[model samples]
Target: MAIKTWELDSNFKNEIAAMPGGEGIMKCFQCSTCTVGCPITELEPSYNPRKIIQMSLLGMKKEVLESEEIWLCAVCQTCSERCPQDVRISDLMGAIRRIAEKEAEEGKIELKGVRAIFEKAFMHQLEKFGRMYEIGLSMEYYKKAHGGFFAGMMAMQKDYQKLGMRFFKKGKMGPKSMFPDKIKRTGEVKKIFEKVGE
Candidate 1:
């Protein structure tokens, strides 16, 4: 990688520390323990937890905030568990993700489209039904993925039709399963979701 001078914001660390679970970044040393424990790094050699923290501490704001490395983390907490410094690596990653979201909204960085769309769609499913509705969730996901209801339905027809037939034959999952009886206290669940406010 070619070196570029960082337009470092000295306050960047403090800004991240202000977010939930980010304070642990300050406790991280360049020990590489986090990196060693990260399963993602084994597959994605570039997804190094130690490098991420070092870059963040150096205030490489644009690169760190915009990196796919942050999003690549599986949040399994192995890094945190293996850390000698008690740096909660997974939580720190979450903080970085939150910062990425805010930066995207403020137009400081480009957002990852599919990741954001599916996150919203999944959360919408949670808010809409008290429990997960797989078919509804899949439809919502496809809707967001394809950009509309009709288009999404048409797209699913090629494959979901086959899957639907299999589900029906097996009496496993299909239309009836998808549209199961909603919880009578769905209203209460809605209230809880509203209180959480996403």
Candidate 2:
């Protein structure tokens, strides 16, 4: 990929530091501790939280916000726990996620592919039902991800059938879960979401 010219916006690091989980980002000094401890790196060699942080610090706004790698973070705190500088790499990832979502929402950039849809669908399900509806989230995300409900269903048919059979045999799959279940204090849950503006 061609590198984008860095713009005059050198405030990315400071902006991230001001975010809720990003306070420790400024203390990093190219230490590799975070990368060495991040389990995601073992699974996906292309994803390195350290590299992502360096990109943000270097003011690579477009690359930082648009790369699917940012969304790949599992939010496991291994990186933060292992960091010698206490940069809180997981928290920095959260800050980057917030910025990316904001940029997409504001039309500063277009979010292509399934990651954005999946995140929104997951959040919507969580907010509405106060819990995860796996089937519902899958349906919603795949519909948007595949650009059509039918395509999504077709693609996920086998996996759904397999999991469905397993759950049914184990007596775990039930109609109640297929339907969205609201907790006793769903209102309170909604309020919490409102407070967080999620």
Best by lDDT: 2
Q: Give the CA lDDT, 0 to 100, for residue 120 in model 2.
A: 88
Computed on alpha carbons, the lDDT of every model, listed in order, comes to: 0.81, 0.83
Count of backbone collisions within predicted model 1: 0
Candidate 2 lDDT, 79-143, residue by residue in tens? 88888898888888888888888999998976544677888899988888898888889999888
Estimate the lDDT of model 1: 0.81
RMSD of 1: 2.8
Q: Give the TM-score of candidate 1.
A: 0.82
Query: Best TM-score goes to which candidate?
Result: 2
Which parts of model 2 are misplaced by more than 4 Å? 1-8
Q: Name the regions of candidate 1 deviating beyond 4 angstroms.
A: 1-6, 146-170, 192-195
Model 1 over residues 86-159: C-alpha lDDT tens digits?
Answer: 88989998888888888888988976546666677777767777777777777888887788998988887875
